[model samples]
Target: MQPQLQQQQQQHVLLQQLQQQQHVLLQQLQQQQQQYVLLQQLQQQQQQHVLLQQLQQQQHVLLQQLQQQQHVLLQQLQQQQHVLLQQLQQQQHVLLQQLQQQQHVLLQQHV
Candidate 1:
């Protein structure tokens, strides 16, 4: 009866040790899960940051292209205005010559 009691005591101690070990393992597993969740969040934030940078670069390129196009359009408009001014000056000169020639012919007929 004494050996039986000692055996029971040993079994109880082993059971307690096992329960403690299980509790420690559970705590470690919870910590690992939390770490994994944090890692995932960090990775997601990095990806979002990279995407934002790419978008901003694309926008910058588009703005530069638009500005170049505007500059080219302005140059073309300026050229067209110069050409129109030359045409207007030529027309005015021709009209003045015609008026002078008509007046000279009328004066000769009166004489």
Candidate 2:
């Protein structure tokens, strides 16, 4: 009877040890899952950084193209204005000559 009682006590101690080991294993699994989640988030952030860099590069190229187009349009406008000014000056000279001729003819007839 005494030996049977000792055996039961030993079995109970063994069951408690097994339960403690299982608890430790569960805690370790939870920690590993958390680490995996953190690694995934880090990878996503890196991908976003790369995408942002590409967009900025494209924006810079577009800005340069716009400035070049503006420069060309401004040159064309200045050339057109210069041509119009020359034409206006020529027209003014022709009108002045016509007026002078008319005045001279009228004075001669009066005299």
Candidate 3:
């Protein structure tokens, strides 16, 4: 009976230790899964940031093109205005010359 009791006590201690080891292994597995989830989330965030940067770069390029087009259009409009002003000045000069010639003809006829 003494031997049997000793054997039973040893088995009980071994069973408790095995249960503790199993609990520790389960905790380790949970920790590893949590770490993996965190890593995946970080990777996803990195990909999203890269995509946003690319989009911003594209937008910057497009904005630059628009500004360049606007500048070219303004230059063309300025050139057209300058040409129109020159034409008006030339027409006024021609009209003034014609008036002077008509007046000179009348004065010669009267004399």
Candidate 4:
């Protein structure tokens, strides 16, 4: 082969190798970027999950507090009802005694 032709062929082979290496490097860089995006998404999902759990816990606490308040209110209402019932019984007794005294007075006057 002529010396100049051999040198040109060698340069051409070097150029092809460089191009192939560049393509492989580009592929690797793209794969790394995709992996980074996936990692970010996973982190966001984990954060959301943690927030959800915290909210659920808070809800449970609020529910327990509401139930306790309801129980206390029920007890208070029962106590008030008992007091009213006692007042009604006393009023009935007083009315009955007055009727009996009036009847006695009428019987004496008739005799």
Q: After superposition, how far is residue 84 of candidate 4 from its true place, in Å?
A: 1.3
How much does candidate 2 score in TM-score?
0.80
Which sections of candidate 1 miss by over 4 Å? 100-111
C-alpha lDDT of all candidate models, in order: 0.99, 0.97, 0.98, 0.98
User: What is candidate 4's TM-score against the reference?
Assistant: 0.85
TM-score of each: 0.82, 0.80, 0.75, 0.85
Mind giving the per-residue lDDT tens digits that candidate 4 earns over 2-104? 9999999999999999999999999999999999999999999999999999999999999999999999999999999999999999999999999999999
Task: Assess candidate 1 and give its lDDT.
Answer: 0.99
Question: Can you write out model 2's per-residue Cα lDDT over 1-111, one digit (the tens) per residue?
Answer: 999999999999999999999999999999999999999999999999999999999999999999999999999999999999999999999999999998999999999
Which segments of model 3 are wrong by more than 4 Å? 95-111
Clashes of 1: 0
Runs of candidate 2 with Cα error greater than 4 angstroms are none
